[model samples]
Target: MSDNLQNDNVVIESPEPVDTTLPMVIYALYLASIVTGGLTALVGVVIAYVYRGKGPEWLDQHYRYQVRTFWIGLLYFCLSGVLMFVLIGFVLWLVAVVWLVIRCVKGFKGLQEKRSPENVDTWLV
Candidate 1:
C-alpha cells in the first residue's frame, strides 16, 4: 500500500549538464595573467565577462580563483621588486604557478570522478 502510494505521483526531471571548459579557460587565463600582468589580467577579465552567464558554481569559483591569483601575483611581484632580494618572491611565485597547474589537473580529474565539493583541497591549491 505504501509503495503504491509513493509511486503514483513520482516525477523525474533530467539534470542540467555542467560545463567543465570554463574552469580550464579560467586556469589558462590565470597562467597568462601571471606571465604578463595588466594586459593578461585584462584578457582574463574579458574572458570572465564573456562567460559570466555560464552554468554551475564551478565557473564562478574558477573566475574568483583567477582574479585572486592575478592580484596576489601582482602584489608580491611589486613587493619583490622593491625588496631587491627577489629570489624569495620568485620562488613563492613559482610555487603558486605549480600549485595552480596541479590544481587544474586535479579539478579535471575530480570532474571525471563526479566527486563532492569537500574534496577541493585534493587539488593542492
Candidate 2:
C-alpha cells in the first residue's frame, strides 16, 4: 500500500548538469602558456576551434575568447619579433603579457559564474 501511494503521483524533473571539461582545459592552457612558452596555448587554440560550436550556449563564448587569445597573442608576438630592431619589441612584449593575463583571468572568473564574456572578439581586455 505504501509503495503504491509513493509511486502513483510523484514525479521528478531535474535538468542535466553542464559539462565543464573544455572550459577547464582551456583555462589551464591559458595558465600553462605563461610557463611553457605557449606550446599549451597552441593546443588550446586547436581545441577551441574543433569544439567551438559543439557545446552549450554559454560555452561558445569561452571558445571564442580562447581562440581570440591565441591568435591575438600570436599576432602581437610576431609583430614584436619583426619590430625588434628599434627596441619596440620589448614594449610590445610587456603589453602582450599584461593583455593575456587580464583576459585569461576575466575568462576564468566568468566561467566560474557560468556566464559568457561580453567581448570575446576584443583584441585587448
Candidate 3:
C-alpha cells in the first residue's frame, strides 16, 4: 500500500452558531480578577473591546457594558488607592469590590436571558 492516499472529495462543516459564550467568559474572567490581582479583568476588557460591534445588537450592549465596567472599576481602584493615606481607602475598596460583583452578576443575568442590559449607561448597578 502507498504511504499516502489522495481523496477525490472532501467536506467541511460550518462553524457553530454564535451565542453568549464570549460575554459569559468575560464575566467569569472579571470575577476571577478578584483572586488574580486584576490581570484577568485586563484580559476580559481586551476581549470585550475586540469583540465589540461584531455581534448582535444585544451582544454589543454587553460588550459596551463590559468595557465601561473595566474603565470605571479602574477609576474606583485608583481613587481608593489614593485615599488609602486617609484610611477611607479601606471602605472605598470594599465598595468597589461590591460594585464590580453586582455589575458582573447583572451582566451575566442579562446575557442568560438573551436581552440587552438594562441601563447599560449607568455607572452603578
How does candidate 1 fare on TM-score?
0.55
Estimate the TM-score for candidate 3. 0.85
- Separately for all candidates shown, the number of backbone clashes (residues 3 or more apart, or on different chains) is 0, 0, 0
Off by over 4 Å in 1: 1-11, 34-38, 49-54, 85-96, 99-124
Q: How do the residues 18-61 of candidate 2 rate in per-residue lDDT, one tens digit apiece?
A: 78678778878977887898899989899899989987788888
Best-matching candidate per TM-score: 3
Q: In model 3, which regions exceed 4 Å deviation?
A: 1-17
For all predictions, the C-alpha RMSD in Å is 5.2, 3.9, 8.4
- What is residue 22's positional error in candidate 3, in angstroms? 0.9
Of candidates 2 and 1, the better by TM-score: 2
Residue ranges of candidate 2 with Cα displaced over 4 Å? 1-12
Candidate 2 least-lDDT 10 residues: 15-24
The residue-by-residue lDDT of candidate 3 on 1-125, one tens digit each, is: 24334443455778656689989999999999888979999999999999999988888999999999999999998899899999999899899999999999999999988888889999898
Give the candidate number with the greatest lDDT: 3
Minimum summed lDDT over a 10-residue window in model 1 is located at: 115-124
Q: How many pairs in model 3 have backbone atoms within 3 A of each other, for residues 3 or more apart or on separate chains, i.e. clashes? A: 0
